[model samples]
Target: MRKTALYPGTFDPITNGHFDIIERALRLFDEVIIAVAISQDKKPMFSLDERIEMTKEAVKSLSNVTVVGFDNLTVELAKAHNASIIIRGLRAVSDFEYELQLGYLNNSLDDTIETVYLMPKLQNAFVSSSIVRNLLKFNGKTDHILPKEVQKIIGNMTSCTLH
Candidate 1:
C-alpha cells in the first residue's frame, strides 16, 4: 500500500516555507497532497481557485505531489484521500501551541488519522503567508518569503506590479 499524506492549509499564496515543508514531506510519504482549505472563517487574499493554481504551479516539478481544494474538515479530506497522516509545518513555538491543539482535536475526532509536524528549514522559519501578504500590502520585498510566482500573484492582487 502506498503511504499517502495530506498537507492542509489555506495557502493564500504558496510560500517558500510551504514548499520546504512539502519537499520534506515528499521524502517521508509515497505521495503528498497539498490540500487547500476553503474556510468561511478567514478571508484569504487569494481565492480558492487561485490558490489551487498557484500551489500546482509551485509544486509542478514534484512528481509525487498533487494540489487540490477541499471544503471539508482536514480529517475528512485525509480520509477521502486515503491518507494516514496529515502534514503540518511549524515555524515557531507559538505555532506549535495552536497546531498541537488542532492535532489533538483531529486525533480525537478520528483516531485513524494522525498529524505530523515538520519544522521549516532554519532560514525559512520566519516565512509565512500572513507575512507575505503584509509585505505585498506595503509593496515590500517578499522574494525571501515566497517563490517568484507567488510573489507575482500577491503583487497583482495588491495592485503592485513587480518589475
Candidate 2:
C-alpha cells in the first residue's frame, strides 16, 4: 500500500521553505498532501482559494503531490485522505516547543497517526509564511524568497493588506 503523508498548515502564502519540506517529505512517503488549513482565526492575508491556487502552482512540478483546504482536525483529515503520517517543518529550536506540543496533542487524539518533522535547507531555515507576508505587507524586498508563481500572485495583488 502506498504511504501517504499529510502536511497540514495555513500555507497563507507558501514559501520556498515550505517547498523544502514538501520535497524532503516526498523522499520518505509515497505521496504528500499539502493540506491548507481554513484558519479563519489567523485572518490570513490571502483567501483560502488564493492560498490553494498559489500552493498548487508552487508545487506543480512535483509528482505524487496534491493540495486541498480543510477546516477540521488534522488527524481526521489524514484518515479521510488515507494519510498515515503527518509532516511538520522544524526551522529552529524555537519551533521545537510548538511542534512537540502539537505532536503530543495529535498523538493523544490518534496515536496511529504518526508525525514526522523535517528541517528546511540552511538558507531557508528562517523563512516562514508569517515573515513572508510581513515582508510583502510592508513593501519590503523579498527577492527569491517565495516561489516564482507565488511571487507573481503577490505582485499582481493591488495590496497585500493585513487584517
Candidate 3:
C-alpha cells in the first residue's frame, strides 16, 4: 500500500517554509496532500479558492503532491483522505507548544492518525506566511521569503490594489 500523509494548514499565502515542508514530506511519504483548512476565527488574506489555487501553483512541480481544501477538522479530513499521517512544519520552539497540543488533540480524536513534524530548511527557517503577508501589506520586498513566482503574484496584487 502506498503511504499517504496529509499536511493541513491555512496556507493563506503559502510561503517558502511551507514549500520546504511539502518537499520533505514528499520524500518521506508516497503521497503528500496539501490540505488547506478554513478557520472561522482567522480572516485570511486570500480566500479559500485563491489559497488553493496558489498552493496548487506552488506545488505544481511536485508530481507526487496534491492540493485540496477542507472546512472540517484536520483529523476528519485525514480519515476521509485515507491518510495515516499528518505532516506539520516546525520553524521554532514556539511552534512546538502549539503543534504538541494539536498532536494530542488529533490523537485523541483519531488514534490511528499520527502527526509528523518536518523542520524547514535552514534558508527558509524564518520564512512564514504571516511574515510574507505583513511584508506585502507594507509594500515590502518578498523575494527573500518566498519563491519568485509567489513574490511576483503578490507584487502584482499589491500594485493593482494601489492603483
Candidate 4:
C-alpha cells in the first residue's frame, strides 16, 4: 500500500524553510500532501487562496507532492486524504514541548495516525511565516528567507507607497 503523509500548516506565505521540510518528507513517503490550514485561532496575513497559490508555485517542481486546503481537525483531514502520517517541522528547542503536546493529542484523537518531526536545514531553520510577515510589514528584505516566487508575490502585495 502506498503510504501518504500530511504536512499541515497555515503557511501564510510558504517560506523556504517549509520547502526544506517538504523536500525531505518526499524521500520518506510515497506521497506528501502540503495541507494548508484555514486556521481559525490565528488571523493569517495572507488569505487561504494566497497561501495555496504560493505553496503550489513553490512545490510545482516536486513529484509525488500535492497541495490542498482544510479547515477541520488535522487527523480528520488526514483521514479524508487517506494519509497515515503527519509531518511536523521542528526548528528549535522551544518548539519541542508544544509539538510534543500536539503529537500526544493527535495520537489520542486517532492512534491510527502517527506524527513525525523533521528539522529544516540549519540555514533555513530560523525562517518562519510569522517572521516573514513581520519583515514584510516593516518593508524589510525577505529575499533570503522566502522562495523566489513567494518573495515576488509578497513584494507586490506590500509595495504600497504613501503619496
Compare the candidates by TM-score and give the number of the best one.
2
Q: Which run of 10 residues does model 4 get worst, by summed lDDT?
A: 154-163
> What ordering of candidates by TM-score runs from best to worst?
2, 4, 3, 1
TM-score of each: 0.92, 0.96, 0.94, 0.95
The residue pairs found clashing in candidate 3 are none
Model 1, global lDDT: 0.87
Which of the two candidates, 2 or 3, achieves a greater TM-score against the reference?
2
lDDT for each residue of candidate 3 in 1-163, tens digit (9 for 90 to 100): 8999999999878998999899888888999999998865678887788788888888888888889999999988999989999998999999999999999999999999999999998898888888877876787888877766666666667445521
TM-score of 3: 0.94
Candidate 4: misplaced stretches above 4 Å?
Answer: 158-163
The model with the greater TM-score, 2 or 4, is 2
Q: Which whole-number lDDT from 0 to 100 does residue 23 have in model 3?
A: 87
**In model 2, what is the error at residue 114, expressed in angstroms?**
0.3
**Candidate 2 minimal-lDDT segment of 10 residues:** 154-163
Native RMSD of candidate 2 (Å): 1.2
lDDT of 2 at 67: 98
Please report, in order, the local distance difference test score of every candidate based on alpha carbons. 0.87, 0.93, 0.86, 0.92
The parts of candidate 2 lying over 4 Å away from their true place are 159-163
